[model samples]
Target: MRSAKLESMIPAIDVRNLKKSYLPINRRAGGKTIALKGIDLTIKSGEFYGLLGPNGAGKTTTIGIITGLVRLDEGSVSVMGKDIISDYRFTRSKIGVSPQELTVDWFFTIERLLYFQAGYYGIRKEEVSDRIEQLLKKFGLYKKRNSKIRELSGGMKRRFQIVKALVHDPEILILDEPTAGIDVELRHMLWDYLRQLHKEGKTILLTTHYIDEAELLCERVGIINEGTIVVEGKPSELIQSLGKGSIEVYLSDCDPEKEALISGFSYVLEPYDGGSRLVFSVDEPEKSLSEIIKALSSNGCHIHEVKITKSSLEDVFISLTGRAIND
Candidate 1:
């Protein structure tokens, strides 16, 4: 530990050149399907961090390793200044994990599930009862306390999983797509609860496909692709680092000639007039719009509407990794 002060202190989660590989099938390949390749990251205490990547991009593998569900072939993980392997009990005790898989015991009622989870953390009987009540209310699962796991809706069950993970009030929280399949209202409600927890000084690491969620909730974000980090920084910082500000042009008519003109510029890439829209980007839109309009007019086309939008977390992810966040 360096210092307790917020300015200089140990991170809640630290991963150093972490690597995990699936064993190769005989006669198929020389090496394994490396799930992680030297992933190095540090998430400060009390920070809301996002882990983002496309499918099979190692997001879940990284989560499994940190939560002790999957063993890593190399590298180290630390939670709250304790090495995960050497201080396994203490490290595990300090962290809460809600995995993506739905594995609830069908027979366990909501209340019993949370109560048993609390007992696993050695919470006293009285305190366990008190905490379960509070968690149920916080997650909007209070009304379903007596309901069996199989009886709860998907959203309610998701909330129960979160409440179960938080039975111990762990200092760190890991949520893997906690809002997936949830309606907008429930998703926002869950976001509010997570925000409140973060305000109470809980470090959070979340993996989500929702770009807007990542942009709104995460202070810092790490984007991994092909088992390596392509970008890591404050969300705003990463967004501002994009080369071209995105521009979407809606037209009353199609014009390939004008679209080609815009695409010729090294800065205005991904230009396509497919399906009745000329969409592209410009490094300096304010200065280049006039030139673009001229080119369009020369091809007997006119812009019906043009909008310059700021880069989003999704944009930054694609710009860095060359793939959409959900891909």
Candidate 2:
């Protein structure tokens, strides 16, 4: 069950009672905008951990606090056992962060920018060139070495940022929505590269609104909302916690009054039939599916298809919050 195959390693990241707040000019008289509310989390050595949340869920705030971009109002953060505040330089040297925003100079080419970033990290002059070339090729940016920042596409720019962050060879990497807004093929390529990185013993913390991506790449994930940690565990575990049973029923046709009859059924907590498809949520999947099929048949409803699927993380989130619509 171990996703990371490293041997005899120590935890690369740790956080305790992490908290942050922001003050706004138009805030309530004495209340501060809570960004992180007492988060206690950890990432074992070489682990692929994901932080999943919707926009405004404080994913950025947590990364900002850990990387020293924002000041912390309470609690502590550490990377590779170095205190982020007290041993600031040492802590930062062991961590790399690829921000969600695209930040670059229009005039600089990919090669020059990467060299500059490595120089800023105090990497030896003799060692920088080889490392830069290797990273560029690995991320498929070698041909674009001389291309200006503005000339590259969105996916290329994201790959460039990742290369720059990794130039210093940090033990832990924090990626904020690395594949956001990119094409399907580019996303797959990026995913392949990240999987390689994870296999090479580099711990990663990923935050993305793309639920399916998180489900694929993350061995375990932490979900947060409204400045609070709602759930933390492996993706499968959280989904299983919701329930063992779920069913989706597709119908060939339906009547206007059929909606009311299906809605009044005791087994149905959630039901939807947009003329052709009728999805159902039930605690006892097998029993409910049978009853639903019988009722539909008795009422002259023709079911075109019926299938059963376990509750996924998306279902868990929606079930917990009772959300009508979501990402």
Candidate 3:
């Protein structure tokens, strides 16, 4: 039997039958584009969840709707059991969004921006200064607090965006491309802070082009494509489900006509190294390698080198989407 307290802990986010579409400005026939096709997803409380997809895959539109930026055509969204529309105030209060695009008030100083953001949540006047100072120092923006938003460097501005989002101390953090365009050092710094926040029981929803980021930080992921979620699972599990491993073979005299024959034995086959190298997935690497070599040798191709590539989150993503996230 489950305890009442535990059962009452509803998912941090619950989206049911979510749908949205856009029509042309002139309202021409056949000019409608569907952004979300009844997306159904859930993120448990205190969970680090990743929403992944290629460009124009409806990732941005979904985020906008969840953050109340885009109105939904149908369906309901809830945050911690509160309806997003009916209880807009309560649900909105729990979420802090860091949008993909860099948005900042060029007029306000970093300090003032944080202060103003905190004020939106009605933070007590006495505690606003403390909250702002704490976030600035945490994000390494204390010294740059007096700098205008336009005066700060790109990295500083990114960090300040995170700081502003955190100023209100929301329970759910929604980050879209949080580490995009930042240097590796700043990215590492942000990753460390995000990890700390997750450990402290904050629910995080991250959308990024970096596969490794999702693999490292997200406990679970949901991949969306063509305006619908195609797969959802732990990163490792998704990869393992595809196959045990992959084999890369370089042939001295490769036959393009034999490519389909090799693909017949595996789920994926791709040409590399100007068509001289062949990479394919396999359930049993040793057995598959032997068979591949035998087949290639019969085609008058000399094996130059062979290597096994371990399955990874990136592979799983590519397998599902048939392309990379940025592509």
Candidate 4:
């Protein structure tokens, strides 16, 4: 293992001008499909980063290229300062990837499966036995250690997949939709565990469709759209740049003259609930609320209720991509 000081100085993963395309199965259909369009990305050691995109946005392709599962048509990639292609073995040894799909031996017991995973990295059964046991207990799967993969529940399988990735104790973890299709409680449990791993200084690269998940867990996020990264920054900073809080005012009644008076203000307004509810987008809701209320009162407009909504990472995503992350 590299020293902490040394690891802190080098990036966990780096890609430069990455481009990839897939050939059509039949030439009669159309041209080749472009998956990635010359994207650059870097994740620092011990940092938790998120890659968020819609389906077919090249997120999985990027992860595949970095983990040596898929061949890249163009560009260079490095893992921990070593060239990924030339130093494939060294790079592969440094990463533990829990892919989105469940690809495990259904016939094998949970313990046996993890033992084989560790053995693939040249770790003996005796050497990783304690580690395996510890992981099973940590994930609440210790009682089912003897159960076969096919017998475990969906949530159990997800936990086991993460355990398999950690068996060899790699320096970096790559999770692709780790919480997809799981129950809310299990997802929260996984989040807490991932937080613990980050606290332990493990570099993590997460690809998720859940926008709020990225906003809550990731230190920085890159939003990919149409096979390219459209934006990258801290969640809070991106929200501030591209989104504005909205103030929704509910009125008892709205007349043409009152509507005209409300529309006169320098704010974006939209009508809801048959023009009785007005939504105004503003930079600062707290500072603008008093003025808006006073203006409405002086104009004989009766305010029923008011709601202030802050900008969120999801709002920023929609503003940049013009579509929801899951869409």
On lDDT, the candidate that comes out on top is 4
Ranking of predictions according to TM-score = 4, 3, 1, 2
Rank list by lDDT: 4, 3, 1, 2
Q: After superposing candidate 1, which stretches have Cα over 4 Å from the reference? A: 1-3, 6-8, 24-31, 246-306
Best by TM-score: 4
Q: Taking the tens digit of each residue's C-alpha lDDT, what string does model 3 give over 145-237?
A: 898988889988888888878888899999999999999998998899899999998999999889889989999999898999999998877
- In model 2, the runs with Cα more than 4 Å from the true position are 1-10, 25-31, 247-306, 322-327
Give the TM-score of each candidate. 0.80, 0.79, 0.81, 0.86
Better of 1 and 3 by TM-score: 3
TM-score of 2: 0.79
Worst 10 residues of 3 by lDDT: 260-269
Tell me how many clashing residue pairs each candidate has.
0, 0, 0, 0
**Per-residue accuracy of model 4 over 217-279 as CA lDDT, tens digit each:** 999999998789999999887887887898888875555244556664555445656656667
TM-score for candidate 4, residues paired by index: 0.86
Q: Assess candidate 1 and give its lDDT.
A: 0.81
The digit string of per-residue lDDT tens for model 1 on 176-253 reads 988988899889888998999999989999998887898899999898899998888888777766645656666544
Clashing pairs in model 2?
Answer: none
What overall lDDT goes with each candidate model? 0.81, 0.81, 0.84, 0.89
